[model samples]
Target: MKKSLIVSFILSAFLVTTLSGCGSTSTAVSGSTDTKVPATAKTEKSTTLRIGYQKYGTVNFLKANGELDKVLKEKGITIQWTEFPGGPQLLEAMNVGSIDVGHTGEAPPIFAQAAGTPLVYLGHEPASPASEAILIPEKSEIKSVAELKGKKVALNKGSNVHYLLVKQLEKAGLKYEDIQVVFLPPADARAAFEKGSVDAWVIWDPFFSAAETSAKAKILADGKDTVANHEFYLATRSYAQSNPETVKTLLEQLAKVDTWSKDHPKELSETLSPQLGIDVPSLERAAKRRTYGIQPIDDALLSEQQKIADSFFKLGLIPKEINVKDAVLPATK
Candidate 1:
């Protein structure tokens, strides 16, 4: 419930109605044209591939460039992108079956799996720890994590920064309840921080970058000492299984995009800055922290993620224990 807590428990037993269920989900493949369909149907139908993206990520760039849509269009596919403020909400849309493919941080899917929402991760983005962090007002006296006790912090529930907050508190030997959590979306949190409504904010870039530039926030802690919190490309179990072709296409195109972003970060950032209405320097700072590459799922990453989930459970944050590896798709060799 509290994003800035030492452990994450986002509706572990509730929101079971969603499709993030990794344990057992859909078996249908992508294109199921019926032999039962009146063999003489007149016009062919195009698949409306609904994708969800968060701001300042691969999906947003794809949408801004219109390249994914263009490439998929050749296959008679229609791309419909829905932008979310952060991962938790993006995964929420995916769970309800409205979004065919979505991207989110490491924590949301783990939380979703704990709740039995039907989702299977196809793969992960290159690891990037710098994208998320905890910030305090520049004028504040919060010199260390220990000072956070009894203070209020703002963060988006179930996002990657939520996990960062948890790990930081644990390192400080503090429980989540030691501080008050002000759960807020990025936009509202920004406004509140400017007005001093909350004591600190746990967030991701470009918001983190934005706050540094526009609001002069100071970094209290970051993902560097915690987890890499890789971005994941995921879909309903049924969707990935059914539309392997679509997923494959998406993967290849995404790999290319990731490569381009990595090789030409400065150019890319300069191009993307104003398009997103973020300051150019802010985008540059956020870009340097990103590492873009594709990797097959490995046991090491799964083990690390398990620790995160188990920590949440051990802290009484979640009602059910989660098996992190059970949800990971087999490594694509």
Candidate 2:
């Protein structure tokens, strides 16, 4: 009987030790604060950056050369490129979560912000005022901006050219209401301009150069003395805040390309010609007048953007007044 009791006692001791070890493990896993994993550590990082680009710009150039991909690949980030007809369409895609980063002109962001799209300015290119212009037919009777009064003018609405058209009209003593504005993308506007459907078409290069060279369009007025045609780089507010290093890498790559492009106009044009489906000469003409450099957002630049926002608000182009500074990227620590 004692032998049997001793065996029972040994079995009880074995179960107690096992149960105690299990309890300790359970406490460590479920109850211990020091053993808990951080919320950030549990989150996964993004692996792809979706970019939106127009037919012509530094972004397009970057895509054409395929250099950005190589640079980003080192960091395990891949790129997805989407071609947009113009700035408005690109920002629209951004609003719908179709794209993460994009390039646009001065005016689209203003309209987008007024409509409450969550975008943050990443950087800007120097003002290339001569890059965009108001064009008439080779033989059109309209000689100047004032003559465009009461005539139908074609343009991509909310594009950089929109502000150009507005400022040019103001300078020529014509109100915004004085002209009939036809809203169309670059391709459609080009067709309308060709078929005499519109008297004037306001556009940016290399479309402007194409119109001048192939379609024989004449310059009615450019943004030279009117508006600062600054091109901006932007990203969705969420993407920018989450992936700042990727954004920085992109800007650095763009800067390198811009520097090379400025010094090698002929090569740059030739490189972009096949991709754009524009002739080399036309691309060259566009490249010649382009100012190449990317700059950070500053108070002076923001002030200029604010003037555009105010002008657009006064003209009822945007629904409500917006502060341009609110769209700027938060300063880094």
Candidate 3:
């Protein structure tokens, strides 16, 4: 009996020890009170500024120069570039958080604002009214914007050219409905223009220059006496609000590039030719038509933007009216 009692006591002691060890391990894993994290376990979040750009513009020039990247790197901000087919597409990317900063023509931002995209205008290039135009084939009989009545017109909807078309029609004393509008992107529009599928194609350079050179398109009317055709630099509202200094740095760099580009049209064309896959002659023509010099958004520009918005809303292009000033970058104190 005593031997059996001793064996029972030994077994009980072993059970207690094993159970206690398991309880301790369980507490350590699931119920520990320690709150300190190790130095190696901590990580600093990295910041990357995503920039959206189209094929031909100041942004493209900026990207090709590599100067902006070097400047940004010194400030611990890395740049990620995404190329979009046009301004509308670039702003669409901005609306979806794919890009933080981008450049676009005047009309895309109006549509974006109406659709509730949180975008703000950071700056604008001087109005290059002659840069965009309504072009007809060289062999075509169309002589004036007034002659476009009941004819088929092709343009990229919601582009800067859209407003130009509207204003041109109004100037010709023709209703917007008078012309049968065909919406197509630059490549398709160029194809249509070549195949005689479109009566006239409203476009901007370097496509304008390309069409003139290769497709034998002639300018019917340009924005010279009509629209401002301002090229705008834009950013997500959150980004501009949070990174004001970065935005300022970008505009400053663009200003410097603009000054350089104005004096070196030949060099600009040569530099952009290989990158754009366009001939130097065509690019040179485009460079001449283009105006450079970045300017801050001001009351006068806002009034012009508001006019565009009002016109679009009146024409039922955008669903709702939007205040242009609402999308301007908040003035820094």
Note each model's CA RMSD in angstroms: 9.5, 17.7, 20.8
Off by over 4 Å in 2: 1-44
**Which candidate's lDDT is highest?**
2
Give each model's whole-structure lDDT: 0.73, 0.82, 0.80
Error of 3 at 17 (Å): 67
Residue 208 C-alpha lDDT in model 1: 94
Per-residue CA lDDT of model 3 for 1-333, tens digit only, reads 343343333233323322322222211122333222223321222368899998788888898888999998999999999998788888889888899899999999999999888887777788999899999999999999999999999998899999999999999999999999999988899899899998999999899998888877899999998999999988876666456556667876777687778888899889988988888888889888889877656678899999999999999999999889777533410
CA shift of 175, model 2, Å: 0.7
Q: How many Å off is the CA of 134 in candidate 2?
A: 0.5
Candidate 3 Cα misplacement greater than 4 A, ranges: 1-46
Tell me the tens digit of each residue's lDDT in model 1 across 37-134.
Answer: 12232222237788999888776666766777888899988888888998888888877778878888888887788777677766676568877888
Model 3 CA lDDT for position 286: 85
Residue 132's C-alpha lDDT in candidate 1? Answer: 81
Question: What's the lDDT of the predicted structure labeled candidate 1?
Answer: 0.73
TM-score of 2: 0.86
How high is the lDDT of residue 152 in model 1? 88
Rank ordering of all candidates by lDDT, starting from the highest: 2, 3, 1
Better of 1 and 3 by lDDT: 3
